[model samples]
Target: MDHNINTKTEEETITSTSIHQESKLLGSNKSSYKQILAIGGGKGGVGKTLVTANFAITLARAGAKVTLVDLDLGGANLHTCLGVEMSSRTLSDVFSSDIENIEDLCAPTIVPNLQLISGAHDSLNAANLPHAQKQKLIQRLQQLKSDYVILDLGAGTSFNTLDFFIAADVGILVVLPEPTSIENAYRFIKSAFYRKLKNIEHQLDARELVDKIVEKKEELGIKTPADLLSAIENESSDLGGKVRLAMNEMNLKLVVNQTRTGTDAEIGFGVKNVCKKYFGINVDYLGNLEYDSAVWQSVRRRKPLAVEFPTNPLVATMQKMVGHIVAEQAEKIKNEKSYE
Candidate 1:
């Protein structure tokens, strides 16, 4: 944590136009795409990176080409989670001009069709990456050659993390059954929703209105996405339509991890219902990873649960979730084709 790393570079003006147009990158333009799944949570120790590593390994084991990009700039240990030591080349190398293209930084792993771009343990400033660098990374990531590119993001509501999550093909928020995890998950959702709203359109008028809604603080203030939508409608029906459409397109998903029991398993449904009620967005609960003492054994062995304990219940759950994701992507392709 050096002072230079935090404020070394002057903060540049980053407009939201690029992110606002990211969702339009459907297979309509390209026949196929390397699906980018960004995993994040508002708080640490909720198993976000572990989930990213195992899920990426699960996809690779299923024969899908996968590139796991460890974007946890603060604490980069995803390589260790996969039992792979830190690569000689990492994000720092790319920043230092040692590597020209990030695609070249891929370090081969034991699993077939799987590669990893390790985060730099030495680049403390990388956590506060400049806006230009952030955009560059996001664009280069889209060009990666793989069926799935999983971005293992750091835990927090920082705009850097949210921008990565928001610009991805799919954003998965990992939550534990614990109360603190649930609260952080909700905060993450709200922060992400507002970040997206700020870029719903380039028009100063619409952004100004969104700013007003976000700035409200009262007993019945704009406390939810639905509330913001109502305010937009009061201002102008046309803008409200645009805002609602933007909110719907987010399609934020949830994954309940480390559920300890049957009762804990029921938390996903409750969280989904509450999100829909307050956020005015339907949150799809992708699946959950049951609390397994053996998960630590797998970790101690320095291997992913999906790799070391393929038959574990959590691995089975990962398999089911992977199938669902694959099917959903296929359907999106099919529907895009029909329109064409």
Candidate 2:
């Protein structure tokens, strides 16, 4: 099972073949290589689902085909946020053989060019999916034929959550301005970085070194991934170079939600700078989402923020964030093509 995009050589080939077969099923003649985006958090109630739902709507309204997946498993509620009724065949059905492919489980959303894959109506232990099952689902997600496939992940640094976050081409970590939220976000990112390194430990030939640094981080003066990398370089510069290259390739976007004051809004920048200094990771602050009564109102009304309160100021900020994300993705694709 490939845990992260950086080490998906085998999974990539399998995904490509699966995607080609799925393209014919979906009647998509253009292409089936959809960009995977995962919205995650360190804790629940950070508005991760809210941001994901609205982001999907904004992208679809902009004429991009979008699929919003509720991967929260047993705690799924993304459908409620999007005002979409759960399909009879949820993601759980895919595992049970009731639904052969995930694409067949897609249910139409109110927003045109948008589809919903609800995670509701699952078994008791849906969240604790087996390793093989999780890998299969990830591969099927890659086979989705759309411009973007957005996953609303469950909270915490659980292996399931971290794996899905790492699998995505783009990961957006949502956090509140509160101290607890910020701390949880840091833990989430740190755990993810460690998990990514562990995934490629064999190639780096530093499994023992990484394990030692993590297990006795304080004793070894390894406070962060950057510290661990420096220690590794001290041991073997060649191995350290490889680790540095991998860490540099990791890209994440941050969003501070429910900000009420100017100070709250600045939290995103602080977190971004801290990540670079401590973890040696590039975190793009995609701006903050202010506190708005309309958010809860929309929830009460069982509709998306854009639909329930189109004139809300928060909606405008979300639109700008979505625009920026789309522009960045376009630039990245262009650069990759140029290099090719």
Put down candidate 1 lDDT per residue, 130-206, tens digits, no spaces. Answer: 88888878877777777789989898888888899888878888999999999999999989888887777554358
Write candidate 2's Cα lDDT for 1-340 as tens digits: 1112133223233433343443443354336556788999889999998899988876666656789889887789988867677768888876777566677989988777789998955676778888898898898888887878999999888888888998888889999999999999999998989888887687767898767667877877887677888887777788888887776555699999999999999989999999988987789999999898889988998888877776677776877777667666666655655686
Error of 1 at 88 (Å): 1.6
The numbered model that scores best in lDDT is: 2
Q: Cα lDDT of model 1 overall? A: 0.75
Model 2 alpha-carbon miss at residue 94, Å: 1.8
lDDT values for all models: 0.75, 0.79
